[model samples]
Target: MRKIERSRMMPIALYRYNLALPLAPFQWNMSQNHDFIQSAQRTISLERDSVDALLPRIGADFTLACELLLNCKGRVVVVGMGKSGHIGRKIAATLASTGTPSFFVHPAEASHGDMGMITKDDLVLALSNSGSTAEIVTLLPLIKRLGITLVSMTGNPESPLAKAAAVNLDASVEHEACSLNLAPTSSTTVSLVLGDALAIALLEARGFTAEDFAFSHPGGALGRRLLLKVENVMHVGEELPQVSPGTSLSGALLEMTRKGLGMTIILGDDGRLAGVFTDGDLRRTLDKGLDVRQVTIDQVMTVHGKTVRPDMLAAEALKIMDDHKINVLVVVDGNDRPVGVLHVHDLTRAGVI
Candidate 1:
């Protein structure tokens, strides 16, 4: 081991030798481990199929679960332990971001005092690999008596937790991804898939729109989608780099460069939008050898420029800019006067892209 570790090429040579020599018991078991993953793939495909088959089979209990959640006046509380707890937290987040108010509560902590987070108007979704986890089972009676709706996710349908739930979604699979078929691998996958199904179904049933989703997820991609109004990130007032329509092309060029936006908005005498001047216009002007000092900006600026309303979405503005093949846009008010300027680079810096 020391000789191989110190040599530059010897390590690679030894590694190849070790791999070539491994045909005994250890290698035989190693090959089995690699092939066993095929079973894992089968498990995921089966779980996906189960989720697809589940929608139609929702039946009355499905309506009951939705009603239980829809009628909930308080938050939906999720509880679990171990691997199930991890999946529960994600489910809780999905529910919260998709219009349902929800959060995760650890069963151990619930027995201590966190149970206070759950109210009679709420529903409890508990996950347990065996429906008989002592920590989870102990809380069942208290949850049931509190008049909180109980839903359980478990691989064993007849387990206590499964029997306790007002509705039980069967997550049963043939075996696990564990070599000894003891680990929770396949079961965890099924649980996650089931939670996603529930969250999406409820999202659609409640008519939850992207605008609604943006309200809850105001910190990440979701928040970016909702919280960014055009005006919030636009260059307003003097930063707009604007010029009077009668200004000389030289004055427009000075305004564009001074503002550093590569463009200038041209306003009519009535403070209404008239046109736009940019470096592109400067190029066209130079093609005719027009002297910047003598030419009027009004004669060369592109008239009736494309504009966006101040109330439009930042994402929508990006689409318009992309479609027009322009990198900057003028924001206009109801009077059609330039109110602000938006640069594509500004949106990129703000993570609006």
Candidate 2:
């Protein structure tokens, strides 16, 4: 059976209940896989256009907002209610990780006591779909009184929150993707895009590079690819399964079994990288002659083997494998010595693939 079939059935009420009818066979489950993506892509493209339209309007005030955030002594403080609150959290997180010190503050929580999280040295961004969310609008006066610069993102530019803002980036959208036109959809996408534009643009202006981004997201895919050194995850010491280049093919096979990596690194004279022998190589070797005792690793090892530096990112290693369409590689040092080997499976296990 295909992977799509193994998915649990969708709720009858949430979708058309007639399992016997109506869809391409492969789409029996996960109808949303392509359908929803197509729908969402429409909304994403629309929002992308909205942000693109915004570029021409990057006036003195927009520059001013950027300058204010750039000069802030503290983090960028984001606040909102409802769906906007959820989007606010993502924006805050993106900003914080991309070299801007930032975090989300729920307006409701702030009204009670969390208002203390905002300070005069901070730049505050407020989000509201209606420009009049009571929880958010109610707290606006206090934020203004605290002497922090206020930036509001709302679909309704004429609303109170926009009126209160020092700079209001128009996030207005024509309509939501929701059937009733009531739920947040396109509007939230535009808001999120705006927040991302701000964060990344500010990140660039501050000279924040990929290394800076890696520091904030060491656990993320790109961060792992760019920041994780081979030493941090490579097998070493007694865990290594390696053999000298002259070892018999059977001996190399034994090393592969003991190491459980489906392959073994072959070292050269003076302990340097020489070549590699894999299970695949053994199979090819057997095709010529089944006598392992008569063969040596040098007779079958791959002389021009793929290799990576110990200091390279795990992500880069995955890319090297993918670009070359290979399955395994040896980790080498500055002197071209095999320190370890990485397989496609290793990247999967390390969450780098």
* Clash number for each model: 0, 1
Question: Could you tell me the lDDT of residue 304 within candidate 1?
Answer: 66
Q: Over all chains combined, what TM-score does candidate 2 have?
A: 0.69
Off by over 4 Å in 1: 1-57
TM-score list, all predictions:
0.83, 0.69
Give the CA lDDT, 0 to 100, for residue 37 in model 2: 72
**C-alpha positional error of residue 215 in candidate 1 after TM-score superposition, expressed in Å:** 2.6
The whole-model C-alpha lDDT of candidate 1 against the native structure comes to: 0.82
Find the candidate with the highest lDDT and give its number: 1
Task: Kindly report which residue stretches of model 2 are placed more than 4 angstroms away from their true locations once superposed.
Answer: 1-56, 81-87, 128-145, 154-165, 170-193, 207-227, 323-325
The C-alpha lDDT values of all candidates are 0.82, 0.81
Which window of 10 residues has the lowest lDDT sum in candidate 1?
A: 1-10
- The ten-residue window of minimal lDDT in model 2 covers 1-10
Clashing pairs in 1: none
